[model samples]
Target: SSSFFGDYPDVVAFILIVIVGIFVAMGSKASTNFNSMFTIVNMAVIVIVVGYGITFADFSLWTGTDAEGRSNFFPYGVNGMLAGAASCFFAYIGFDGLATAGEEAKS
Candidate 1:
């Protein structure tokens, strides 16, 4: 059954897309129990990390070259800023997993 289960995740994601679409079309939003908790924690971590980074991180690190002799450290240049923004686009992709669950979770 491993072969069957191999494609199961995609099947499940497709099914969830359909269900969430229905809920959205009905003028309502689907809710999750841990969503608020997760959001608060996510924001708190970001604030703390950014604050700590600005306060104490080594500015010279980004100026240092990587194994490829390229400046790969974060916030390295204008290109780095844009690259960071592009990388961060995947952060919100975390939300896509919340829909691929069994109804037993709401308990």
Candidate 2:
């Protein structure tokens, strides 16, 4: 029942964008309403992952020395922690638009 379309990048790209455009064409309220349940489910998944993942984390990976002589939980030191924090900050930036959802929602 499956056919291959790997050769058609343009078709694939167009279809992907068209599908996203359909969702974007739906006003924010409609889209937000449709996604609310999914959002709760996503949050639950995040919580579960964070809770269970810590138990499996190896304390050994946190220990190690980089090119520098200093050693700590972060092998690369404070700069590495700062860089990691910065990257995580940007990764969640897409959610900034969601903040306005409160105002966008109809009473």
Candidate 3:
């Protein structure tokens, strides 16, 4: 008699992938039970970071002269802040995909 579960690499990989995918699906379903706890933990972490951050905040970095002896807090003024934000706009844009997922999540 010949067995179906022989030394086939492709078959083994496919079986493993399907098994893991099912496990992930089941785990995600179970995660809903702990969603509130996860939310509270996330909020606590944010609070702790903000609290500790203010304690060690250094206002001097915003002041002082640079190598060129510029005394302004913003060397390039508001334009520099705008340019920095513009560069990060793509990062913000990526969040739109996550936002769109909300619509599908409701179903």
Top candidate on TM-score is 2
Worst 10 residues of 3 by lDDT: 28-37
Q: After superposition, how far is residue 29 of candidate 1 from its true place, in Å?
A: 9.5
* lDDT by residue for model 2 (1-107), tens: 65675544787779978865676678766666657867899999999999999999877756675567567565666888899999999999978777786557563
Ranking 1 against 3 by lDDT, winner: 3
Off by over 4 Å in 3: 1-40, 61-64, 67-69
Q: Which stretches of candidate 2 lie over 4 Å from their true place?
A: 1-29, 59-69, 97-107
Error of model 3, residue 8, in angstroms: 21
Q: Output the TM-score of candidate 1.
A: 0.33
lDDT (C-alpha) at residue 59 in model 2: 77
Model 1 agreement with the true structure over 1-107: per-residue lDDT tens digits: 35646643687789978876675455422434344556799999999999988988677786667877767475367887888888887886765675565433443
Q: After superposition, how far is residue 46 of candidate 1 from its true place, in Å?
A: 2.3
Cα-based lDDT for every prediction: 0.67, 0.75, 0.75
RMSD of each: 9.7, 7.0, 9.9
Lowest summed lDDT window (length 10), candidate 1: 26-35
